[model samples]
Target: MITPLKAVLVGCGSMSRAWTAAAKDIPYLELTGFVDVVEDAARQRAAEYGSPTAVVSADLENTLDRTRPDIVFDCTVPEAHMPVTLTALHYGCHVLGEKPMADSLENARRMVAAASEAGRLYAVIQNRRYDPNIRRLKAFLDSGEIGPITTVHSDFFIGAHFGGFRDRMEHVLLLDMAIHTFDAARLLTGADPVSVYCKEWNPPGSWYEHGASAVAVFEMTGGIVYTYRGSWCAEGLPTTWESEWRFIGRQGSARWPGDERMQAQVVTESGGFLSTVRDAIIPPLPPGAKTGGHAGIIREFVQCIQAGTQPETICSDNIKSLAMVFAAVESAETGLPVSVSV
Candidate 1:
């Protein structure tokens, strides 16, 4: 039988629960250690996960040395991502980190360089891409049924009253939430950002200490234009977590109603003064593993590490998604369009 890859999990915060649960379902992965700034948190995670033999430590470096894991699962905050990833690389361990890559583009670049030097895989978990409905939408866009997508739009609205760090975070919407939609836009359109014009504001009756609403228009490669409107302070008529999306291509347009349902319209035939429009049948999605979200990403991360291949959210490729966030923020701050730096 093949030996399972040992893993050391860092950060015993809320997101760690999802990571630990996913690891349990992957037979090829063994959760060997749990690390957090607070030792009690790590201990609690180990106990909850039934990892009696798992090493629990407040010091990550010490835990890594003790466990000698094959990989490091980083569930830490964005600001700590770079340091955690670098430490893992130095220890000759692969890293699977939570999204947004890093707090800044410069740190993200450094992480990518370190991973390349270490010759180990470094992947970010963009779990939103693993949704079956998202997969179906991507497939439809790729099938040329959309015929070269030229425009895309997404709207996200939610009134979450989480009382924590996010309440006081700056650019809270762009940094914490919009990255999902930005990354999903790239996946669905297969395009990189060129430039973006953005506007950010805090609406009246908002609870966040900083910007909680924003609108951005991004120019992408192949002349594709993507627009985004999001608000974390919206109280009523909140959109689904996935966000509503509309994609317009030369031949047709597709819409995802922020849920599992999708619909498309295409022009069947056209003349000088007349045109015919019909519903474009969306194709069935391909078969995939039963697990998705964090679990799906975990499975792919392990498979890529074992196979010596790069996963979809490899740091190098994921940087573009991160760039979109920074670009939008920069535009909002400067009140001018800014070129996306990748």
Candidate 2:
């Protein structure tokens, strides 16, 4: 018989809602506790999720010791990821947490080393990786129908008026949001960043206290160049959260509007200034592709735990994505190209 893994969710904030809700759909997971700095917030989440028996507390270590959970869902802020992950791993629990692995690359590296020392699974909730469109697009790119990729471009424009901590944060766009687009770019290009040159600024009429828009150029491995232009305070005609993407390859090119209708074409005839091209069919998601976003990552993490395996968003790889984010920030600040690492 399969034994349900007991889980303690830390940081019962708005983000925790997704984690708790996902836990409910996985029969192999049981909510054992809720922990937040604000004790009432923990209790509120337990009640909100209908996990009446869940222990609620403000102290993470105390709850972990009491609940003796097998897994910890860290929905905490970026600053708390290390503590939450390290504490959970110390308790011999696997951890799955939100994106941008840590506030800094050093901390991310430390967390990775700690997870390795503890011999526990530590994965990030890079939910966009599980999105159906990205899966299908990545599959098509991998199929070699697009040939070897040479260049990539992505644009994210959203007029987010989020009146919260985000408005006051420094390098708001790069730190708070660009991780998704940068990570997605990595997934599509199948490469790690070699170096990045970026420029950031708070445009006129922007609500963010720091950088609200940025343009970054990345030299990716395999000689693929990836560029990103994004503006959180951009009003009207906003791109999807996934961002508009275009991939150019030796034989063809593919475009995803970051929404409905993705298109790809490969050259069929090698004549004339403009070679004749035919539509490259993007294959459907392979059987059993996880497409449930938050629930999908959570379910996969559970299955990996059950099967004694690791997930795609394991800390090691996710850290590379986080590295790109930090590199971009450094490049923007120094007005020069910066190499990415860790």
lDDT of 1 at 72: 97
Q: Which residues of candidate 2, in runs, are more than 4 Å off? A: none
Off by over 4 Å in 1: 1-3, 272-274, 289-291
Residue-wise lDDT of candidate 1 within 1-342, one digit each (tens)? 455799999989999999888888888788999999989989988988887899999999998899999999999988899999999999999999998799999999999999999999999999999888899878888999869999999999999898899999999999999999999999999999999999999999999999999999999999999999999999999899899999999988899976779999988898758568799888877776223889899998898878778899998999999999999999999999999997
Candidate 2: TM-score?
0.98
Residues 1-342, model 2: lDDT tens digits: 666899999988898888888888899789989999999999998997897789999999899889999999999899999888988999999999998788999999999999999999999988888899898888889888979999999999999999999999999999988998998998888898999999999999998899999999999999899999999999999999999999999999999998657999999998799999999877777777768898999999999999889998999888989999999999999999999988
TM-score of each: 0.97, 0.98
lDDT (CA) for every model shown?
0.92, 0.91
* Predicted model with the maximum lDDT: 1
Which pairs of residues collide in model 1? Answer: none
